[model samples]
Target: MTTQSLDESGNDDTIDWLDNGPVKGKSAPTRMCLATREHMPVSRLIRFVRSPDGDVVPDLAAKLPGRGVWVRADRDALAGLLTSKSGFARGFKQSVQVSEDLVEQVDLQLLQRCQASLGLAKRSGAIILGFDQVRNELQKRRPGWLLEASDGAQDGRRRIVGLAVALYERVRVATALAGEELGMAFGRDHVVHGLLKTGQFTDVWTKDYRRLYEFRRLTDDVWVSGTVGKNV
Candidate 1:
């Protein structure tokens, strides 16, 4: 993984998740609850535990046995985990294993969860796809958020964005999961256009996306302030 120093002002984004305990804990040992403040979504926050080697694993299947540890599901959160060793260790009340590559694993899990959720949403007709279809959905009513594929053609996405401006309250362009990842969300080999259905599950999905987006932005060396809008 590539590493770059970030401006101190923007470092706060990582800190925000740490304060919130974003990792596996809500439904079971494996399922992580995505939490956020306000109507906007946040990252996948659930409970977790440190491994003997210091690995931060997402207990998706809830099969891993042990007391769970909580982190923000981002690199900075991993850094915090490393820094506050005494606190976390005390919380676990045992010799918890910590891995150096914990952050990378969490990132991969985050992407996988996004893709998997997208696939489920697509299967349930919770997602609308293609530029034209998405445009039509926009006409029906403004959606809670707008999602665009980061790898999509600029012109195509721009056209869709124009339609979204009138129909959606917020827009989020996803870069983590591109063409194939987008398609998997809908059970297709490849997909570009997709919209999510509103429900409790969807709320959690949105929050996870928001957290992933912010973490990606920070790690990518793009310093963005204010709420996420058009462009990733």
Candidate 2:
């Protein structure tokens, strides 16, 4: 199913998918940004609103009250919006003070969003942790995705990746977070491998996961190296 939203100009716009498939269930109607003029799913957009003090605040949760504006969640897109001649001011229809660290702020918020979603997935029992559990789960059913600590051991990651690849043609392996971060999500000291099962929680977690993945890619800050299985 598709969703529609009204742009700043009061014209109806259809939001397009940025991924191969639409997220299951009813997502809120999408938003159109003044900077890009492209209607996109909210998951692919970063929201900002004028604070009571007239400063532009990043509303990662989209819960803040006020007239809001959205920018595509890309490094270049946000950088352009901030650098453009009066882009944000013109869009909000006011002279708002944009934060100098807006890009960093958005990146931090997106990271937190991804971490929170992973924690939620663990609580919902939609995730399996450790190499043995993940490998066993894969044998029973195909998971939605595999997660490996950026610093995890090459041996275990390679084994799991090979198994996932054998079962699914295109397996998503998230290596942006470290083992400690993954452990925090699963309520442990550290975790090197995890499997996200296909279910309701997967739908929610995947959106944040993809956003975090893209954000890291755009910023060129993806995690690259760490000792594997040190916790084991």
Candidate 3:
């Protein structure tokens, strides 16, 4: 559902989507859908506030000395914090230091996590990189997902895309993926090609990717828009 607050001129504004489904009409900050604690399985939908040290810690983690502020997880949700300062401040019942880089921090965290998973996948041999090598892997495993580089050449990417389409549900470009980063996954320092296989590592990567991509799609739809919706 949509959550809203009035702007300086008193106009209603939309908050980012923090929960299930898009909020109708109004904007609301997005909240984490999973449990607050790492040990719990039950879903606790709580909005996290950025701590003074610029850390996004969960309030339930500890009873800190001072009051905490709430923010949605996406960029739009963070933007809501800037525009609807009065409303959010009212909700917190205290003053909060809202920095412009709050959402950037969150974005960085998500990207890092995704990259780490890619690294793990590489270590496990569930992922392969490089043009010819990855294509060969694709032919063998017929992977459930494909990862093309965001900065890869159009014709080169298309040739792989065509192979993926031939294999159906088993190919995608890694738009949020960095060529250099993917290369590091396999012990290299630079790369633009990669392949993903269905295995324990793939399962783990897919789950983490689900959460990361979901949040990314909500805010920065540009990176994940076309490639993520299908195949990968």
> Model 2: per-residue lDDT, tens digit, 1-232?
1111224564322333122222236666677755688888787777777667667778777766656778777766777767754556665655667777788888878878778888888887888988899999989987777888988988998899888777764566778777987787767899999988877876776677666666566244322221122221
Please give the lDDT score at residue 184 for candidate 1: 65
- Tens-place lDDT digits, model 3, residues 1-232: 1222334454432433223322234333343322121221111122454356533444322234444434333455455555554544344433444445645565666666667888777766777767898778767766645676556677887777677667665344455556665565566776676777867776656644554555454444333433432434
Pairs clashing within candidate 2 = 151-226, 152-228, 153-228
Model 1 agreement with the true structure over 83-202: per-residue lDDT tens digits: 553434444443445555656666776678777777677666677787788788878865544556667677877676666654453554444557776776666787766666555456
Q: In every candidate, how many clashes are there?
A: 27, 3, 10
lDDT of 3 at 14: 42
Candidate 1 C-alpha RMSD relative to the actual structure:
8.8
lDDT of 3 at 57: 44
lDDT of 2: 0.70
The worst-scoring run of ten residues by lDDT in candidate 2 lies at: 223-232
Q: Measure candidate 3: CA RMSD.
A: 9.0
TM-score of each: 0.62, 0.74, 0.62
